[model samples]
Target: MGSRDLHQGATMTAMSGATIHQVAKAAGVSPSTVSNFLNGRPGRMLPETRARVEEAIRHLGYRPNRAARQLRTGRVQVVGLVVPSVANPFWGAFALHLEGAALAAGYHVLLCNSARDPERERAYIDELWADGIRGVVLCSSLPSLDHVLPLVEQGLNLVAFDRTAQAGDPSRMVNISVDNVIGAQLATRHLLELGHRRIAFVSGALRSVNRRERFRGFRDALENAGLSPDDAIVWSGAADEPYGDLDVAGLGRRAAADLMRGDDPPTAIVAINDMCALGVSAGVRDAGLRVGQDVSVVGFDDIVLADLAAPPLTTVRQPMADMAAAAFTHLRECVESDEPATGRSLLMRPELVVRGSTGPVPPPR
Candidate 1:
């Protein structure tokens, strides 16, 4: 049978009172054309045929069922977004931008929290797929991405953010991130320029690509200046802990306290993120030391509360909106394309925002 004849035969019986086939038969066109027209799919149809389909739909009072359409297509008009923690200020800001961008593009975003757990991330991925989510933007920082890659290979469009390089196959996934190394260098450079030689680095997880890159930047700046940055490093011991399970602020506070216990405490501190920096600042005050004057503190991410802290925060600012826009655009391209996006890594620049938290090193007693 001819293509049109086949469509007519397959759609002959009306599953619904006003089925797509009836409209196609009335309009003297194929059922696929009618389906396309009703679904707002863009295509060139003869003016008379278009008019006929419209009139037939009106005459038959046909209403397309979105649920049935989704089932037929095996997809939904939405995408999934997985983040380490929705409660983290940085992730929260990112989620808002992502949701806004998705909405602007006529798509909905289903936000899921991985809590930095592999199992939870795995489950969420499966659940999202079962819900007909064809695309996902993942911002996980776990040590392994074993669970995620298999799904992508199964035809899921994935955009990796924050810790993109860890996904193993950049060829099959869209990767987007800020130059965390530059951000850390900026923070460390600011402290060094302030004549703070004995600076302390407080960090949470090293497994996260962002954290590792930031640390590398920190070392690069110090080594470039002929200083030993390794002597200043202090792990927060939260590397293996899931997000929200360990209080990063408390980790900062404890790290600051431990550093102060030394006979020669650091003249300045650099925190992995703004939340930890705030904790470090509080720790300094609790130890009868001034922020800025006694010991300067610098942070990364420049979150909203960074400025509202006691001394405010001198930090590196990630371009959340720009990154979100780029990631959304990439994912949408992958979703719409017949070929997958490959081997492209977009690294955005971060700026240094000097606030009240950093200053010249204090005079020794």
Candidate 2:
């Protein structure tokens, strides 16, 4: 084409919203080179070549067609995050942080609430696949990965954030988790140090990997302290299918009530989560006992509300934001690469946050 014809073609393309072809033509490069630049894989391009492509993109105000790119690449720049329930404060905070991190990486997050239902989790996965989303951060609370394994086999770039042990093949997907066992050990040892021999453990479902690990840690701590592990009262049951507040705090209250009614009640209680600890506090008051004074309580997952409770709860702190960022970076690498990225697992350290809800054991009557 002549100079005037080339100018006119560029103008027309600009008026119609510039695309890869127009940008490539203006830069005197192939479409693949433009694609490479757009995807942040500007490999082996001379500085002059890269500058030309960048200048063309800026001059034409070109916005790469994500849909067209998806058609060619078989995946979109969107990732789905599946959580058990956003209603839980811990998960709520987690989702917010993950969304912010994903946005910073030039990707969008599609939030899916599985409500701890197997069928719902499977349905969300199917919908995400149908919508061309190949990356997922699954925070499932279930004991089995039967519903998620098929998609992994089909080449989904999945990261199991919390309940990772349940994911069948750790070698096939990225896993990020907190050291729940250590967190639980810290809480239990804190109670033990306060001279409380009779400690109660209030937990949700033992099927959840995190909860199970916490329970094991509690037992290990008791054993290490030369106390009979069996003497540590444990109240755990099958969690509700459609998990809710009742499944958490309300169940905690019920367990606390049962523990209090016993002839030999525990002097201190360690709960599965902050929500449960809060409920146990309420249950203690209802049973004519002061929470921190009469019966000390400790919780896991120092959620935002942990500090706002009547007596701020002593709990375990997980670096949720850092974990989210690491998981997203790893999943994005898998999504954007030709081959799936090498699988890796990250275990974040958990800290103990001592607060007003726990104190020295009370004097015997």
Candidate 3:
């Protein structure tokens, strides 16, 4: 081969392992300029310079090393989502909407299930932080966020969902939730208007912040109606369980059966969520009672199933898609901001959707 041929061969070998430096050299630009273009922050670069970089990348088959970039910047184009459980379909729907919002903003999500375990949630946040993730949307709704406070102090932008802000939360943490107290009051008031004075509140455990607020709302509505809150039967048989996200339906079914068998059975039931309400309906059937007639049922979190259940369900509708979008937008602002800002709480109003499952209390049997 001639000398020219040997030179061309050497150039080909070098191009095979092209780096950012080589791309900058070929494009006649500085490495920092090339970096800015690659990172989607091409600020005030002349059009021709960008074209040259694009051409160089195409010619050399250059691929940016994301891991190396993350290592240097201490952040990535990905956020973490730690949820309590995926077994419940409401959570599944929320995840879908949150992922949609993240994709639109040029970011991806890493989802983890903590089953409402504080230790597990803390561990997941720690792992994400170690992996260079600087933002997270936590949906555990644990009463106290003390477990994850240390990580938040270290610059983790956290958005707490399905839970209201608490006194102990980090100053820079965002909290987003439907007003649980009002939502529950709406549910109970609907039953009260239906003349369901013998009402019962059913749930797995009152351990989480949201659950506690919901229970409080149930009591408030009863007391405001000139009825003794103490007269309401609260069945929280699974309160001692670690986390009852998966078996909530089962818990509701059992509560219904036991409550219905009592000497003074409740005329109406208020469930924690739609899944639990569906189970309660089934239990009412098992007791030879017809839902919406012999016994009334009301639920929270008007998940899709609520509309499709037999006789449908009366539920409190949470604006899930809107809430998810807001979570992403707030978390992104925190992640991209140059300086940390004081966090804010967003309390969305809930709508009570009346359906076939709730009706006036049955005539004296």
Question: Between 1 and 3, whose TM-score is larger?
Answer: 3
Instruction: At residue 43, give the lDDT of candidate 1.
Output: 57
Candidate 1 vs candidate 3: which has greater lDDT? 3
lDDT (10s digit) by residue, model 3, range 248-277:
888889899999999999999999999999
TM-score of each candidate?
0.84, 0.83, 0.91
Tens-digit per-residue lDDT, 124-174, candidate 1:
999998888888888875546688778887888887787646545635876
Tell me the tens digit of each residue's lDDT in model 2 across 58-152: 98778877788789878787999998778788889998898898899889999988866778889999899988998899887566767877887
lDDT against the true structure, per candidate, is: 0.81, 0.84, 0.89
In order, how many clashes per candidate? 0, 0, 0
**Cα deviation of 33, candidate 2, in Å:** 8.1
Clash-forming residue pairs, model 3: none
For residue 104, give model 3's deviation from the true position in Å.
0.7
- Between candidates 2 and 3, name the one with more favorable lDDT: 3
Runs of candidate 2 with Cα error greater than 4 angstroms are 1-62, 164-170, 237-247, 341-343
